[model samples]
Target: MVVLAGIQEGKDAIVEEGGIVALVEAIEDGSVKGKEFAVLTLLQLCVESVRNQGLLVSEGGIPPLVALSQTGSVRAKHKMITRN
Candidate 1:
């Protein structure tokens, strides 16, 4: 998912297939590495897409992302705020 989120086309496909929620779920319940990867993938998905950013917040992505930011590594916290 992280690799797929790297390209615009891939990000589009993932979003079309509802990847955002999956990524959020991963962050909520995944392993340490998985959460980090999910965060990175979400960052890629939201980087240049305001629509995705809105969808992310609408789909309940931020709380867990914020939670991850609090408990995750410094790099993960960095990734979370970088979206701003």
Candidate 2:
């Protein structure tokens, strides 16, 4: 929840400081609420900075996000679309 709140407040450093990896892990393995928050946070972070987008792509963030888009909830898929 801290990550989500941080991202919402435009904290790219949170993502840069390994938060992206944790979020990706959550998308892959966390509960529904976790995945939702993770994806939403990532989307917000990516939207806030191109650097965070690059960081996400470089950290192998795309595949899991694509996977989540394919299999996750409607909101998750929507978040993925917004991220792109």
Candidate 3:
């Protein structure tokens, strides 16, 4: 939830310091809520920083997000699409 709040407040530095790689990991292995929040946070972070967007794409964030869009819960899929 801290990540969620951080992103909502436009705290990209906080999120980046917390680690974009960690967020990618969460999207890969965390719970549904975790994945959703991670994706949302990444989306927000990416919006504010081209560097973060490049990091996400380079870290293999896309495939999992694509996979999640295919199989994740409706809400998760919705967040993925809307946020991306």
Model 1 bad stretches (over 4 Å): 81-84
Pairs clashing in candidate 1? none
Comparing 2 with 3 on lDDT, the higher-scoring candidate is 2
Give lDDT tens digits, candidate 3, residues 1-84. 435535545455545566578878888899999988887877777776777678889988888888888988898888877764
Write candidate 1's Cα lDDT for 1-84 as tens digits.
888888988999999999999999999999888888898899899987999999999999989987887898776777677752
Which is the better candidate, 1 or 3, if ranked by TM-score?
1
Could you tell me which 10 consecutive residues in candidate 3 have the lowest summed lDDT? 1-10
TM-score of 3: 0.77
Task: Provide TM-scores for the models.
Answer: 0.88, 0.78, 0.77
The candidate that achieves the highest TM-score relative to the unseen native structure: 1
The lDDT leader among the candidates is: 1
lDDT of 2 by residue, 6-69 (tens): 5445464575478888888898899988998898787777775788889889988899888887
Please list the residue runs of candidate 2 whose C-alpha ends up more than 4 Å from where it truly belongs after superposition: 2-10, 82-84
Supply the TM-score for candidate 2: 0.78
